[model samples]
Target chain A: MDVALDTLKFIDLTTANIIFLFIVGFIGGLVSGFIGSGGAFVLTPGMMSLGVPGTVAVASNMCHKFPKALVGAIKRFRYGQVDIKLGLVMAASAGVGVQVGIKLQNFILDKWGQSGSNLYVSLSFVAVLVIVGGYVFYDAMTADKSGKPEAVAPLALRLQKIELWPMMTFKTAGVRISMWFTVPVGFATGMLAATIAVGGFIGVPGMIYVIGASGLVASATELVIAFAMGLGGTINWAMHGMVDIRLTVIILAGSLLGVQLGAIGTTIVKESLIKFVMGSIMLIVAVSRALAVPKYLAELGLLDVAPGTVAIMDKASFLIMCGALLMGAVIILGSMYKARKAHARQEQEAFGQA
Target chain B: MAHEMTKKQAVVRMIGFGAASAAVFGGIFLFANPLTEIFSRGGMYAALPIATVFLVSYVHGGFASNLWTALGITAKQPAKTLRPTATKRPEVRATLNA
Candidate 1:
């Protein structure tokens, strides 16, 4: 599955590639700005489909991502959704987590070669998506059932009580907890990100459930963590001459627009909707990753699946991946539309009052 | 209210972003061979991507921001009803003491 850089011949940007890049970039940015961890999931595969090598795809994606994340963080900051103190603390710990994650990744790569590495990544993706996404979905549903938004988990409340050393306060996130608690959660998110490319799966929930940040702040803060991780990851991959600038530029062009729109959409919606959207994307993405696992297992000879079965699984995986993005876009757009209508109604009411 | 950008501000942002993006593209196009040669130099190759990431973040990031504002998409003010409170929750006292 690993496409070697030496074998990759640079191709001129075709019109299709250009158009696709812009569209995906916008959508990916929208998802990222909304959920804080979706652009890479789409952009990496999107570029790979265009004859870009895997490393180049990853590198280019990272190259585009940092700036996008930076812009997103700034925009969200203006809306007062970002908790800089908390974001910086988590980001610092996550940096170390990335180093450990890379070492583990290299170890897997050395032991199983490319297929094994792919299997490891895919399995981790499925596992994290299932557990985290499932919990989020279940929580969202139960909250809806109760006719009240889901409260922070009991586990997070207990964790917050420990009063460990170097206690920090995030006023915006409305949490005052020890730095010790945040480190492990941030580290795990980074580790998962190193493996799966979507750290927000862990990062957002970790902040919400573990650190007790509201969904809005948690999602916005993830951008800060993402920027740090992407900056580091880009440098690492670029050194190997793996970054394709054309790919980076193309994706950036679209994501910027999408991210800004996403950030603005947040202001119009209720806080709970953020959780709803995040949980939805996480669950569907879990399904998408789960679909890919059988194919990986088949490659490892762990399962004696048929060729057509493998083909179906591969298609299913890609479809589900696209489904995750589509589902996210639907939620954001639908919520934005509803909010706009409500806003218009309020404006009319105010005019009547005047 | 969405602040309408004056023509001068719009022109300045556009030119700044345009020049940076062009320089990046030009650097890649004209110096492809030399850049690749230096970047693939193993240990030092790390700097190339790092530098480029920063460069792209500044240029492309700026372009994206300005482009969005130019199109009238901007962050909205916080809803008045959702204001934060400085008072600690009473639940914190019981839980923290325990």
Candidate 2:
């Protein structure tokens, strides 16, 4: 398909655009750092709104994502929240999963063209975010009301009991699950990542509810998967000249800092809150993507929507995406600040006693 | 409680790490346009962008890590690690810091 010339043009950088991207990158980084996967769902769409083509926006955002994930993974590793073996195992399979994902995307793009492709991506986003996000939100609520640690899912417990060959134990994540169980999660994660830039939507939840890892370990371990997927995705995108390096670098400037702060945040808060934040953001982002559905439907000639309505919905969707990022930031920062004060109080009391 | 070292020493380390971070960030932006053009040219050139992200991650990521330590925002994991079950994570019942 001859991608139109206008679709790939690198827009002249305006100061306003740069500042906007930096802010988004920072918030996206924050969420990613704290939960181990996110940011790209907003960043990709954020870039496209600024006159970048859809593919370039996706590619450039991806280019920045791996590095940020790497930084977050390293920080979380220091906290012993990382399962290096589990991460590597997941990553290896996710690599293959990504290729399959990309192939599926290309197939859709070839047959359906851009508008159809957009619809497919949007539908996928809505379906996954609503279903998975709803499950996570319910779990968070249950855990919150009880004010206790989450019980391992019955499903994960059963899976662990299977005497499948190549059963593996992840010391950090503290689970002993068969590779058969782990592979699908990794594969699904990669596929979602390729479909939408938010693989953690599946990756993190899959770890918690399916594999029975603690929220802290599950989230931190996600960085490993993100790093692997991001690296592979970026290379594939860059190979096709899809990456706009300027966007990648500019976003990284803010994201690197955001990611580090986020990683530190994981240490200070209760594990359940991670699920809360993840669940809330996922639901909100689903709405954001859902808002765009009508626009795509109009384009596909499947709906009788007016042009003005489509335009309005598109803008609305973008704003909501920004809102999702903002909400995630607010939750993370608020938790961190509270944790710091309590820690300070404890320290001062200890000093007085001494 | 990131004050493992004296404030003065921490200040020096912060400045040192801060400068290194700035230098690397500056270096990337310095060649930003041309480098982007070359890296995005496609084909085998894909490796360049991947490697570049890796380098930037290490340099910038390390700097950010240090920046946090210098600012005294380190994680307090050892306290929680003593608990046998992860389900026993401390109840952070405090509301948002007003």
Candidate 3:
């Protein structure tokens, strides 16, 4: 009975640690709510730093994510944003992609050891985030400047014309594309999720540019994918006795509140703001992960650096990651407040006219 | 169409669910040690934690939704019109590529 409990390093829940987890969970959930996929990237690391083992942190984080996602997806679904068929199809393939990703990860870990594995993950994070994040950020800026509605990418239009067999239509997403086209996007999403713990970074953009879903639909549908992935992952982890329920519930308590607020935000802002927020966070996180590259390199004997310097870089990287989350939350709340005020004023003027 | 909830009804439901959520969380903390052991025991016991979160999410998620509504932080009116409507289409069956 106690055998599984004895091996894992579960932290004692002090008042301070609980407060920290709650605050981090809230902000992380807020971002996840707005963009469809986030929270775990910060939550897992935040827990690990609190002395919870890596696997336990991951398991507990997954445990919270699905329910959080279920709530968010439902809330967004009411807003007419979620596309269930699209989400289910992508999730089906994402499930397979996860298995492939895990096998690849095990191979890397075995060949290169911890430091090597860490280096590979960090490098991949930097590469994917910069290339994709940059394009997204640039797109957001240009669209905002032009003051034009979001145009479907030409790539999506071309793919839609392919006349591939078994074509499917996603009503909510307002796209008719080959089911074959969706498989790779979902697979890449799962692969990235297994590697970086935030597949939305790829999944959301993939849906927008490739599958031709609007940003709103893409982000909302992502919640469905997250829910499926989170549930599947939690069940697997639980079988190994890896989930720490205490940590899971405490985070859930805060995230549940934050996610509802985030769902409301989608209604208040323009759809392009979703891209702006997602892109901004991605770019910042890429820099933070990049900083950790040197430390991992030093550990693998590929680079020489003072222990103090490596330690400094590690701390800086974590702080920057936290800052990125905080920045995202601030932008979301501020925009929500401003939009609400303007909306109220408009309503007041109209009432006076009546 | 579903009947719209009055402001008064929103307040009553928010308080009810909030109290229930707090009580559940408090009870868990009260019996923290033994609960943690049983919940993390792997195998059949894994269901305990999964079920617990599902239960908590229902209670807490309900409270959170009502809390926002009571505070007048609800979504904009005519939310259905905010996004584009999906076009009517014929259903397609799943096919595997050779």
Candidate closest to the true structure, highest DockQ: 3
Poorest stretch of ten by lDDT in candidate 2 chain A: A1-10
Query: Which is superior by lDDT, 1 or 3?
Result: 3
Which pairs clash in the backbone of model 1?
A25-A254, A25-A255, A26-A254
**What pairs collide in candidate 2?**
none
**Ranked candidates (lDDT, high to low):** 3, 2, 1
lDDT of each residue in A1-354, candidate 1, tens digit only:
222233353445678888988888888899899888796787788677777777778877888888789888988887778888888888888888888998999999999887788889988887887788877776666664322334556777787667677777778776777788889998998798888888889999999888887777889999999988888787777766676665666677678778878988888766677777778887787787777777778777888888898888777877778778878888898988887777789999999999
Candidate 2 regions with alpha-carbon error over 4 angstroms = A1-8, A144-149, B1-7, B78-98
User: What lDDT tens digits, residue by residue, belong to model 2 across residues A101-206?
Assistant: 8899999999999899999999999999999999998888778543355567778888887768777777777677788999998888888877886788998999
Candidate 3 per-residue C-alpha lDDT over A1-354 given as tens digits, one digit per residue, 9 for 90 to 100: 123345355778899999999998889888888999888878888899988999889999999999999999999998888999999999999999999988999999999999989998999999999999999888787775333446777788788777677788887787888888989999999999999999899999999999988888899999999999999999889888888888988999999989989989988877788899999999999999999999888899889989999889888998999998999899999999998999999999999999
DockQ list for all candidates: 0.27, 0.23, 0.38
The segments of candidate 1 whose C-alpha lies over 4 angstroms from its true place after superposition are A1-9, A110-113, A142-152, B1-63, B66-72, B79-98
> What fraction of the true interface does each of the listed models get right, in terms of native contacts kept?
0.33, 0.47, 0.48
Candidate 3, CAPRI quality class derived from DockQ: acceptable
Ranking by DockQ: 3, 1, 2
- lDDT winner between candidates 2 and 3: 3
Question: Under CAPRI classification, how is model 1 graded?
Answer: acceptable
Candidate 3: give its CA RMSD in angstroms: 4.0
